[model samples]
Target chain A: MKRLNKTLYSVSLLAMALALSACSHDDDDNEISEVAPPQPVTYTYQIKVTNLTSGQPASPIAVALHNADMPLWTIGESASDGLALLAESGDNSEFLANTALLATASAEQPTLPGESMEVSVSIEDNAASTLTVAAMLGNTNDAFTGFTAMDLSQLEVGETSTRVSVAYDAGTEENTESAMSVPGPAGGGEGPSEGREAHDFVSMHPGIVSAEGGLSSSVLTSDHRFDNPVLRISVMRME
Target chain B: MLRFNSKGFRKTVLATALFASAGLAHSADLEVTVQNLTQGIYFTPILISAHSNDASLFELGETASVELQAMAEGGDISGLATATEALSANNIANPAEGLLGPAMSTTASVTTDEGNDVLSIVAMMLPTNDGFIGLDNWAIPEAPGTYTIYLNAYDAGTEANDEIRGSGAPGEAGLPVPPPLEDVVGNNGVGVTATVANDSVHIHPGNIGDDDATGGVSDVDNTVQRWLNPVAKVTVVVSE
Candidate 1:
């Protein structure tokens, strides 16, 4: 994780320079300059994510390359509508489209328990020093897990960074774990609900209370309860 | 030209070395601010210690020593303070004087003794039997800068988390409900369990709060008392 964070830091410094040029205002606006600015060195990163749960299968992962100015998620705040859509319905299209994401990629299929999937994403024509990876646990209501705006610039060529990500509540939906809201096979593939019953602020997941354990109203079983560090993610700079 | 340049470089190097040595000879005064980030949990009296590198308050996966048990179970720092005093450490006890509520914060400052180069802080979280927020032996960097650290909740491994209101003395079986926490916590809990599965210092498994505040599986308020791993934020500023 530390190595990846360092690589991201270096990448972000270069990205910052590019972002400044992209948004810089010149004193002379009389002539639109046709000269193209120097494009930042593009780097390709391959991220491999593994679902470490015993039974919970993860939805498709959302891998993005962006600058440090963008933070995909933060605790104690309300979830973005884009994030809400992804967490509740296991879709990444809206998340990628809504955020000014430099580049985005996703797994082709749902990653099952103890399963791993690798997706490669590249930033073109711009310097991007940070990377954010997000994915949802399809069994829960709105629990998504991933890193946010992590520095990727310090990574040298051919080096990799790894992190164990804990689950985070999106605060967009409650953990009803009912048959009508969950998209996992345990809930028979229910998609996003028209309305939510979860908390409104993003926070650390309090974990599931399955019916087998205590919460009598929960439709979840013992298989639904999970611990921390649910996902092991590795980001390797390929270029 | 080469001789003159070498002579000037040597003089500059000597001056730099002298300045660095003089800086190291001085002590540091630090301003510490601690915030309880959890919305539902309350922190008892806080104990911030600046001790030597030789001592540590707690270690993960280890059994709680008698002194650690007293602090974790009852929020008492007298034992740990005595231990640090034996080593001539700088200590700050009970900056908040009493329970610090959720989203509240407390600040304190301390001037470190020359050799007390490490800093650590601890506080017991109420509504739990033996859980405490701790910043174990962190190396205080000599550089003059501000540093922030997040603290995790730890289990003392001394008693079972029966989730009922009980005594705060070491080796006691249930959680202690102080006057400030009595109204906040619920009652008529059937008791979560009577088992201490992992008898070593470990990350707290989190509270098992129920929707029912008056009578349920747990005496803790489900909406108000449960927390994630990180419970406290510590910011330290090292002054020259």
Candidate 2:
């Protein structure tokens, strides 16, 4: 009876090996028949921005994903023409078309003070490892805020990074604080003009010295004054 | 009771050196850069120093030292330089040579000696009574990388911020009118105040001036000279 049991077990093992070979043969046949390209992997990011200022309304927020070779704007350097247009006029059309961008998204309307906006951008089969966000302070001459060239590669799926940004003077336009040159609701004047300030390098903004603060020619009031950390931004990897 | 003496300090330093030579110390060569971020404010001759952990240039909520008072009031860094030298600090005085104008920058190189692991920077802001930019005792990182720091404006609290034109001497009561600022600053002004409310080092209240450049409550220009916090940016690059 024991000899019979051992023979039966050997037969069952041989049968299992034969069945595995048959399954492998079927998989090879299927691979040969199906010749379509592999599906592309999609990477999606969700960006939420909040205006922290008491009075300064932010322009349409511009978000872009790009490689680390370039930055939207640099400190102690001249502002690009695209950056100058957005900072002075609150327009993002030109900035969105930056040559280095792999994917871009922007808010359609102004982000009022104490308001938050979320934008999502997606790209397929490309490694855009850096993120940049920017918006103009509508009441000032050319003051803007947001971070640039933030590394997004380390963030895994469903992870988020939060950062607070300080105001920057674009230096493309002087801080005259006059209604004729400011294009915001407080000013209701013309957009960016033809000339740049003598000190035409990006730097930290000196803040608005409104008419109530002793700039008699300024159209802005004391309510429009703002300080550092005007914007809070968070970036999350959705997929 | 705890007693302190120079001999005891020297012995402690010698022991630290012996232990550091056994492979625990991190000495570095550093490149320091300071930039005036204000649109219209000028920085007086700056004093940059790297000293031991116990040494400091100034502390907030404390009375200003006489040497610090001279530098904050008159941009005279000689006294502070001498004081830090006694502490065996690596000092760089006035890398800009003269006043560092708005939107300008200067650089200095310092190779720190053993155990000098902290940095401090100080400079007077022109066209104000005793306003200064200060970086108080920041630790030098052990890693080899670049670091950035933002500095705020502080009032030395040794003199009143009388916005009118006056002497730059310690205990005086007016803003210094340098040759470059002579044309821009207004004259024949009454004065902002003759007294200081806070006698300790504190954040400076921004300047206030009227539209009347020829005659106003203050001599400084409100629109041009006013600045927010973080009036200066410092960049430090450390390498072995």
**How good is the docking of model 2, as DockQ?**
0.28
For model 2, residues B18-130, the per-residue Cα lDDT tens digits are 53432223356999999998877899999999988788899999999999999888889999999999999989999999999887999999988766788999999988889
Question: Cα miss at A155, model 1 (Å)?
Answer: 2.0
* Residue-level error in angstroms, candidate 1, position B63: 6.1
Identify the runs in model 2 with alpha carbons over 4 angstroms from their true place. A1-39, A125-128, B1-26
Reference-based lDDT, residue A119, model 1: 94
Model 1: per-residue Cα lDDT over B11-126, one tens digit each: 56646875343223224688888887665677888889988777888889999988889988888888988888888888888899898876577999998876677888888888
lDDT of 2 by residue, A89-204 (tens): 88888988977788899999888999999989888876556888999999988989998889986666788999899998888887888998788999998868787864678878
Candidate 2: deviation at residue A119, Å? 1.6
Global lDDT scores for all candidate models: 0.79, 0.86
Which candidate gets the maximum lDDT versus the true structure?
2
